[model samples]
Target chain A: MVSLSDVPLTKDRFQTARAAHLWLVLLLVSVSVTSLAVGASGTSLWGAFAKILSGQSLSQMEKVVLWDIRAPRLLLGISVGAALAVAGAVMQGLFRNPLADPGLVGVSAGAGLGAISAIVLGSTLPIGIVALAGNALIPVAAFFGGWLSTIVLYRVATRGGRTSVATMLLAGIALGALAGALSGILVYIADDRQLRDLTFWGLGSLAGATWGKVAVAAPIILLSILGAFTLGRGLNGLALGEVTAHHIGIPVQRMKNLSILVVAAATGAAVAVSGGIGFIGIVVPHLLRLWTGPDHRTLLINAALLGASLLLLADVISRVIIAPAELPIGIVTAVLGAPVFLWILLRRRGMVDL
Target chain B: MLIANDITVQLGHRTILSNVNFNAQPGTVTAIVGPNGSGKTTLLRALSGDVDYSGQVLLNGCDTRQLKSWELAAERAVLPQASTLAFPFTVIEVVRIGLQSGTSGETDSVAMQALNLVGLPHYANRFFQELSGGEQQRVQLARVLAQVWDPVLDGTPRWLLLDEPVASLDIGHQLQIMDIARNFAHAGGGVITVMHDLNLTALYADSVAVLAHGSVLAHDSPMQVMTDAILSKAYECSVKVNTPPPSGFTYLLPHSAGLATVSQDSL
Candidate 1:
C-alpha cells in the first residue's frame, strides 16, 4: 500500500519545479537560434552571430533574408505558439479538466469558418466593411468568430452560475460540427484560387507571416497571455471545486468570466494569424503537468516557453524537410505531437479515467 | 459569535430549509444533528453563506451577505463534506490554497502546523488523491484549519463550519479530529459541525441542535436535547439513553424496528 508519508516534501518539489522551468527556458533559446538559422536562403546562424559580434555589415540580400523574412516568421511562430499553449492551460484550468482544449471547445472550428468565409466571400461583401478591415480582414473575422463561439458555448454550458464540463464538451462538439458544415459550404462555392487559399489556411502555416500580420496579432496575444498570469491563484482555488473556491474568497463568477475572455482572445488571435495549429495547445500543458505537477502558476509560464520552442522546432522541420517547398506547420505538429500524446495516454492508462 | 436567524433556503421549487434559527458563540462547539435528508447539510451550507437564503447570517454582528468574499474568508473557514480535485496536488499544496485569501504569516509553517494538528505531520508531501478517503477528509480539515489557524484575529474569534467532517474516519481518527475541533473551541474559536454520531456529539459538542424537516426541533445542551423521546421521534426509531457510572455523559443506543418486533413477539 502506498502511504501518504512517501510523497516528496514541499521544498523538494519547489526545487524541481524551478529546475524544470530553467531547463525549458534554456531549450527555448537554443531552439530559437536554430529556427533563425534554418531557412531556404542558407544564412548560417553562426555566421550571422560572427558578423554581428564583429560589428561587420551583412550584404543587402543576407540582411533582407535574415531580418525581414525570417525574423517576422519566427516572432509570429513564437507568439502564436505561446498564445495557443497558454490558452490551452487556461482552458484546462477553467474547466477543471485536463482534457479541455481550444480545439475541443470549438474555437478552432469557429476560427476556421471565419477565415474561410473571408477568403470566399470578401470581394462580394460591402466595400465599406472590406475597406475598414483592410489587410487584416481575415484575422479580424477569425477572431470575432472564435470569440462569438466561445461566448455561445459558455452561455449554453453554464446555467444559473455553474459551468458543467460535460455539457461544455458536448456542446463544443455540436458547435464544431455546425462550423465545419458552414466551412464546407463556403469551400464548395469557392473558385480554384480560393480553394487553394482555404486548403492552406485549414492546414495552418507560418509561411505567410509578415511584419504587418505580426504587428496586427501581437498585442491581442500578448495582453491575453499577461492576463492569464493573474489567474493562477484563482485557478488553484478552483481545483477544490467552485463552492470551495468561493468559500476561500475567490470571486468565482468574475474569475470564470475573465478566464473565458482571455482564452477566447488569445486563441482567436493565434488561429487568426497562424491558422489552426494543432497539438501544442493540448499536449504542452499536459506534458508539463506531469513534470511539475498541476500548479498553474509555474505551469502557465513553462507551457508558454515550451510551446514557443516546440513550434519553432516544428517550423524549422517544416522549412528544411522539403527545402524550397515547406510543409504546413499544422501537419508537422500533428505528426510529431500525436505519437507523444498517445505515449502519455498509454503510460497513464489506468491512472486516468478519461 | 455566529448567528443564523430565520434562514429559509429554496432550491428550485423545493424548500430545503425554512425559518431555521441557529447560533454559535465563541469558544463553543455547536453540533447540528439530524437523520439523512433532514436539511442538516443545507442548513450548514446556508449558515456558511454558501447558498442563497431568505434570512440573515451575522458574524460578529456583521451580516455575512454584506461582507466581501475575502472578508468572509478571514472570519471563517468551511470544511465541505467532499472535495474532488482533478489534478494530483500534494498535501501541502492543497493546504496552501487556504492561504490564497492573502492571510499573512509563514504559510509553510502554518500549513505544517495544521497538518500536525490533524495527526498527519508526515503526510504534507503526499499526493492528496493517493490518501484514503478518511485521510482525504482530514487533509481538507487541515486546509480549513490552516485558513483560520489563529483562533482569535483582531479581537474577533474565527469560525469553522464543517459538514460531516468525520463521516469517513475510523474510530481513532474520528476521536482525533473531534479533539482537534474541541481544541479549536477551547482556544476561543467557534465550530458548527453537522454530525451524525450521537455519542460523539454528546461527548464533544457543548450544545446540540436537533433539526428535522427543515426546522430546528430543539436547541439546548447535549443532556437536554439528547433525550430518548426526541431521539426516537427525530430518527424514527426507538432509542435508549444510558448514563455510565462516573463520567455523567449521555449515550444513545438505537433499537431497529425489525429487532424490536422480533423481541416483542418473543416476549
Candidate 2:
C-alpha cells in the first residue's frame, strides 16, 4: 500500500548537468592544449601563445610544426571525436538501445568503403567529375555510402516502430563484412603508392591529418553536430517510444529523418578523414549517461566535449607511446573501448532484457 | 465534444473498426468495453490520431487532421496500455515530459501533485524501470495527468484518452484509479478509457460503449450497455447481471461460476 505523504520532491538533473557542462568545457580546453603541445616536433604551445600575445613573430620551426601540422590534426581530432560521440548518442537514442554505435553498426565501415573507392579509383574517373569534386570527393561519396547503410540498417532492424537489438547488431555484422570484402578488393587493385596510403588509412590514424583534410571534414562534422543538438527534445520523447512521442507533440517522422541524415554526414566526414575509429561513440555517450541522467539535451553536448577530450588524449598517447613512429589512433581506441563495451554488456545483461 | 464519424480502421484485408460513429462530451467518464480483439483499443487509437483511420475526428470543434500535433497535445493527453523507457529517467522527469507540451498554469509543482494524486509522490525520485508493473502504470498515469492537469482551460475542456488504464492494478488500486478518472470527469475533463473490468466500468462510467466484432454494439448509459444480453452476446458467454441491494449498480457473474459450484458440491 502507498500513502500520500508530503515529501520534498527532488529536482530534475538539469543543474548538475549544467555544472558538469562547465567542467567538460574546461577539460576539453586543457586536453586540446595538451594535444597541441605534446606532438613529436615538441612545439611548445606556451612559447607560441606567449610570443603571439606579446606580438612577436614565430620561429620557422615553431610555425611549421604548430600551424602546418599539429593545429590541423588537433582540429580534425576534435571534430571527428565530437562527431563520433554525438552520433553514438543520437543513434542510441534513435534506436532506443545504449549499444547502438555508428561504428559498430557498420556506418563507419560503409564510409570506409566509400573512401577506399575514392582513393583507389579516383584517377580513373572522368576529368569533369574529378574537377567538380576537388578535395571533397572522398567525403561526399562517404556521406552517401554511410547514409545508405544507415537507412538499410534502420529498415532491417526496425519493424512496426520497434527496434530489435539482436537484429540490428547482426545486420551490422553482415554489413561490416560486406563493406570489408569490398574494401579488400579495392586494396588488392591499388597501385604501389596508393597501397602505402591504404595500409595506414585502413588502420585509422590522425597521422595523415592535414589542413586540406580538416577543411573538408570540419564543416560537415560541425553542421551535423549542430543538427543533432536540435533533436534533444524529440529524442527524449522518442525514449518513450514512437507513438507516445507523437502524442507528446514531437514530429517523430521528421525528427527520425533528421537524425539519420545527421549521423550519416558526421560519420561519413569523420571516416573519410580518420578511417574507422571505433568505440568513442559507444564509450563516451555511455559514460556520460552513467555520469548524469540520460537527458539528451545535456548528453549530446557533454558527449561532444568528452569525445573531443578523450580522442585528443588518445592521439597524445598514440604519438608519445611509440615516440617517432605512432600507433594508429584506432588501435588505441579499440584497446580501450572494446573492454568497456564488454563490461557494459555484462552489467546490463540481466537488467535490460536485451 | 469529441466526435468520430465513419471511423474505419483496416489492417490488410481485415477491418478493425468499421464505420464506427461515436461521440463523447466533456465532463463525463466514457468507457469503451469489449471482449478480446473487439477493437476497443483501436477505436481509442483512431480518436487520438495514433492509427490511420478513414474518418474525421473532431476534438473540441476542430478537425483533428487540420490541427497540429502540438495543438492536439494541448487539447488531450493519451495513456498507452504500457510505456517503456529506453533510457533510465526518474519518475518526476518522465512526468515533466508531458508538462513540456501541456498548457498548465502552475507548472512547477503539477508533476509532484499528479504523482500525489496517484498516491506515489514518494516514488518521484525512483527510476521508472525500477518500479513494479502496477507502479509503472501509475507513473504513466501521473505523466498523463500532468499533461492535462486542468480539466477545462479557457472554458474549453481537455481530454484524458487512456487505454486499459487500470488493467494492471489490484482491486484496491483499481478502485483508486477509477476514482481518479471519475474525479477528472467531475472536474469538467473528458475521460475515455478502454476497460477490461466490466464491473469497474459499470461502477465508474457515466457512459459505456459496447463493441462486438469491430462495431459499436451499444452506446448509452452504463445501465443500458452493461445488460446481460449485451454482455452475453458480446463476450459469447452466459453472464448473469446482478443489481445488488442498497447500491443497485449492475455487477456480473459468469453463469459458468454457478455450474462449477454445483459440480464442486457434488464432489
Candidate 3:
C-alpha cells in the first residue's frame, strides 16, 4: 500500500555518499583517539602525545603501555572491526538478503573450535607446526578452521553453479552447532591453565591483542577488503536477480565465487585474531544501509569506517566500564547492537517478509 | 535480427519447448501468444539465450552461445516477467544497472530518458520496492529500455526480448507499453514479446505466432492466424473473430460454456 510519490527524490545520492564517508572518517579518528587514551592505566592521550612531541624520554613502563600494548590493541580492533563489517556487506550482497551475517554462516563457530583445539591440544601438535607458529598457533589454526567450515558450507549450499541462500543458512546453523559441541568437548578435557584460556576466548575480548598478532592478521584482512571493494558494481547488478545480473553483463558465477572467497578470507582472519567479536558484522552494514539506500558501492566503504569506529567505541567502553578488570568486547557489542537490530526489524515490519 | 531454429528445451524429463523455430527481424514486432501452459514464456527464454536448448540461436547471423555475456548484453535486453529485489534501491540505481555493459556515458541522463519513455520521468529517486505492482513493472521496463536505449548501434539493430511485459498493467498502461514496443521496432530495433491479450497482439504486433502444447500452431499475419477454427482449436473453447467492414480491425469474442443457461435463469 506504499505510494511511490510519497518517497521523496530530492537528495542527490552522490552527495549523500560523500557526506557519509566524511562523517565516518571523522568519527573513526575521534573514537580511535579515545580508545588509545583510556585503558587500565590513567595515561591521557595528550600526555603521550606531549611527551613524544617534546623530545623527552619516556619511562620503560610508559613506552610498554603505549607503544607495545595500546597501539597494537587499537590497530587490531580497527582491522578486525573493518574486516567483519566488510565481510557482512559482501555476504549480504552475495546472498541478496539483508539478514545474512558472517556469524550466521558458521565462520565464528569454526574459528572458535579451531582456537579451542590449539589451546587444549597444543602439546600433541607436530613439532614443525609448533616451531613455525611459535606463539601464533592459535590464530593460524583458527583461520584455517574458519576457511574449512566456509568451504564445507559453500559446497553444501551450491549445486550446478547456483547457490541457494536458504540452504546456506540452514547448513550454517547445523555446522555451527556441531562446532560448538566439539569446542565443548575440548573445553571439558582442558586443565586449569587451558580452561582459563578457553573461558576468556569464548567470551571474546581484545585483551590479548599484540603487535605480533596484528602483523599476522593485517595483510589478509587488508587484501580481502580491497578485493571486496571491487565487487560493488557486480553486487549491484546481482541485486536485480541472477538472470538479470547475467543479462546486464556481470559474470554471475565468477562474482559469486569471488564474493564467497573474499568473505571467508576476511572473516576468517578477523575471527582468528579477535576471538569472535559479535554483532558488528550484522549491525554495522544494516545500520549504514538505512542511510545510504543499499547501494553497495558506497555502503561497503562506509561500513568499513563505521564498523571500525563502533568497535573501537565498544572496546573503549569495555575497558572503562569495569576499570582494572575488562568486560568482554562481544558482550558490549551485543548490548549496544541488539536493540538497534530490533528497531530496524520493527521499522521494516510491514515492508519486508522476515 | 534474432533467429531460433529447432530449439528444444528439456527440463528434466519434460520438454517445455520442442523444436520451436522462431524468427524476429529488425524493424518488426513479433508477438507469441498462447494459453496458460503453452510455453510462450519458455520459447521467449530460449530465444533470449537464458536457457539451454538443443538447437541454434543466432543473433545477427552469429551463434548466440559463441558470444561472450557482455557482447550479448550489448546487442539485446530482456525484461523478465517478475524481478524480486532484496534491498531498497532507488529507481535510478536499478536502471543504472543496465549501464554495466557498453560505454554508455552520462548514465543518469540515459536512465532518466528511459524512465521518461515509460511515462515515469519523476520516479528516478523513489524507492523501487515502494511502488505498486504495475509501477514496478514499468520500472523494470525502463531498466530494459535503458539497456538498449539506442535502438540501433553502428548499423546493427538492438533487440528487446520481453516476457509478459504488460501482464500487470491496466488498459491505458498496456497501450502505452505496446506503443513503446512498437516505437522501438519502428526505430529499426527488433521486439519479441510474449502476450496473453490477443486483441492487443492483433492491434500492435506486426506478426503473430500462436502456440499450443509446446508447439507452434500457426505463424503468420494476424489477419491470417486470428480465425475461428484456429483459435478455437488452440484454446479448446468456442471463439469468434469479428472484423467490421470499414475499420478492418479484429475483435475476438469468446463464448463461455455455461453463460447461456446462467443468463436465462437470471432473466
Candidate 4:
C-alpha cells in the first residue's frame, strides 16, 4: 500500500505543519490566559478563580471586569488578529508577493473609509434605511468598500494575468492617499462626541469591545478565516502562476475570486470593530513564513495563531504602558512591527522579485 | 492519441494562431518547431487548455474542453518554458505540489523517483529559489513528471505537453531532458514538445510539426520534414539540412542568403 505518507517530502511537510499547529495552539492558549489576567483594572483571572474555588459568590466588580469587559475584548482581539493575518497570507498568495498585505495595499484604508462614513454620515441617512440597516450598516459598508478597492487595485496592477509589483505598490499608495483625504474631510465635520469616538477609533484600540460588536464580527471573521484555510492547496499551486495552477488542476479563477472575497470580508469585519489596526496583517505572515517555509496550508493556520498571540501581547502592553491611560494597540504594533518590516526588506534587498 | 483540430487563437486585434491542426499518437515523441513568434508555444497552450481558442482538442477520444480540470489533469501534464516561485519553498515541497491532484494514486516514492529521473533527488532539501535557472527548470520538470507518474494508467496512455523544456539547459542537460521525453514515449505515453534546437529535434522527435506565420507548414516524419527547402522557407533564412555519412543523423547550418550556395558546396 504505497500511501502518500511514504513520500519523504510529504512526510516532512506533514510533520512541519503538525508541529507548527501544536506549538502555535499552545502559544495562543497561554497568550489568552495572560491577556485575561493582566489589565489596569487589577481584577485578575487568578483572583476570581481562587475565590470560585473557595466557594464564594463573585463580586459585581470582578464579574463586570472579567466577563463584561475582558472576555469580550479577548475574543474580539483573537478574531480581529486572526482575520488580519490570514487575510494577509491570502493576499500575498493571490498577488504572488510577500509585500501584498491588506494594510499596505489600501484594502484596510478603504474599509476604514466605509466604517468612518457609516459613523459620520450615518444620522443623515433616510430614517427607514437607517432603521432597516441598524447596527449592521458599518460592517456591511466596510465590506463593500474593501471589496471595491481590492477589485480596483487588482484591475489596475494586473494585466493579462500578470501582476506588476511596482504598479501594485504605486496604486496602493494612491488609493490610500485618496481615502485618507476623504476621511480627513469627514473628521473635520464631526461633532464633539462623534469626533472623540472617531479619533480613538482611527488610532485603533480594543477599549470598546462589547458583546454586541463580538456578536457581529466573530461569525463573519471565523467563517472567512476557515474559508481562507481551504484555499491552502490552491494558493500553493498558484505560487507557480495562474496558468500552471490551472494546469495542475486548481480552479484558478474560482480560487482568485474566493481569495478576494475572503480577504475583503475578514479585513472589513476586523476594521469595523478594531478600527485601523495595521502591521498584524503584514508582520505576522512574514515572520511565520521565515519560521516555516511558505506552505499556505500551514502558513494560514500558523499566521492566525501567532497573529492572535502577538496582538494580545501588544494589547497587554497598550494597557500598561501608560497605566490607566491606554495607548492604542495600533501604536504598539507599529512600533514593534515597522522595524522588522524594514529589516526584512533590507535583508532581502535584491531577492524581492520587484 | 492527442488531436487538435482547427485551433485558432486571437489576442485583441491580432491572430496568434490560425486554424492549426495537429495530432500525436501514443508511443511517439512529437516536436513543434518554428521561428521565434511562429506560435509554437501558443499552439501548445491551446492544446493544454491554458488559453482560449476557437477550436477543439481531443485527448484519447475525449474533447479536452468537455473534461473538468482534474479530469484533464489526470490525462496529461504540462511543462511550461519557465516558472518562478512566489515563496521560498524547498525543492521537495515544490515537487510535492504536483501530487495534490494527480491520478497517480498515492504512490510511495513517485516524487523521489521523478526527482531522480530529473537527476535532482539530492537537491530535495535545497530552496528552489537558490538553484540556478537550469536546475530550477529540471525541478519543475520533476514536478510535471510526478504529476503523471504512470504514463499509462487503466489502459489509457497519459501525455506530456512540454513547451521548450530545455531552453535554459546546458547541452548535457538538454540531451538528458530529450531522452526523458523519448523514454516517456517509448513507455506508451505521448510526448509533444516545442523545441528550438533543430538538430536535437531531428535526433529525438518521431514526428515534426513545422509551424510558421501562425499556421502549420508540415506535420510528417523527421526524415520527410527536415528538408532544406522546408527549413529555409519556414525560418526565412538559408538553412542547409545535412545527413552525415557514418551516423545517418540529420543536422542543420544556418547562414546568410548569399552564402547559401557557397556554404553548401564547402560542406
Which candidate tops DockQ?
A: 2
| iRMSD of all candidate structures | 4.1, 2.4, 4.7, 5.8
Q: Work out the TM-score per prediction.
A: 0.95, 0.93, 0.94, 0.93
Give the worst 10-residue stretch by lDDT in candidate 2 chain B: B99-108
Candidate 1 C-alpha lDDT tens digits along B21-62:
999889999999989989999998888788889999999899
lDDT of 4 at B134: 94
Q: Which sections of candidate 4 miss by over 4 Å?
A: A1-14, A126-137, A151-174, A352-354, B101-108, B255-259, B263-267
Across A1-354, the per-residue lDDT of candidate 3 in tens digits comes to 234465366887756876999999999999998888888988667886788899987878788888899999999999999999999999989888887887888887887788889999987989998998886899888988888999999899998778877899899999999999999899899999999888788777888889999998999999999999989888988889888988877778888889988888888888877787888988999988777778888889998999899999999999999999899898999899899889888887887634
Question: In candidate 2, what are the lDDT values of residues B70-185, reduced to their tens digit?
Answer: 78888999999978898888887888886673224466489878988898888888889999999999999998898888999999999999999988899989999999999999
Question: Distance (Å) between predicted and true CA of B67, model 3?
Answer: 2.7
Model 2 lDDT per residue over A1-354, tens place: 356555554555766787889999999999988988997777799999999999999999999899889999999999999999999999899889887878777888899888888889999999999999987887777777787888898899877765555687799889988998999999999999999877777778888788999988999999999999999988989899889988988878778879878988899888888888889999999888878888898999999999999999999999999888899999999999899989988888899635
DockQ of candidate 2 is 0.59
Q: Model 4, clash count?
A: 0
- Per-residue error for B158 in candidate 4, Å, reads 1.2
Tell me how far the alpha carbon of residue A76 in candidate 4 is from the true structure, in angstroms, after superposition. 0.2
Q: How well is each residue in B68-155 modelled by candidate 3, as lDDT tens digits?
A: 8789899999999998887988887788877863224577778877887788777778889889999999999999999888899999
lDDT of candidate 1 over A86-200, digit per residue (tens) = 9999999988887789898898889888888899999999999999998799999999999999999999999878777789889999999999999989998999999998889
User: Compared with the true structure, what per-residue lDDT tens digits does model 4 show for residues B1-267?
Assistant: 999999999989899999999999999999999999999999999999988899899999999989988788888999998788888888877888867642243642687788888888777778899899999999999999988888899999999999999999999999999999999999999999999999999999999999999999999999999999898899988788889999999988767777897887886
lDDT of each: 0.88, 0.88, 0.87, 0.88
Candidate 4 chain B, run of 10 with poorest lDDT: B100-109
Q: What TM value does chain A in model 1 reach?
A: 0.94
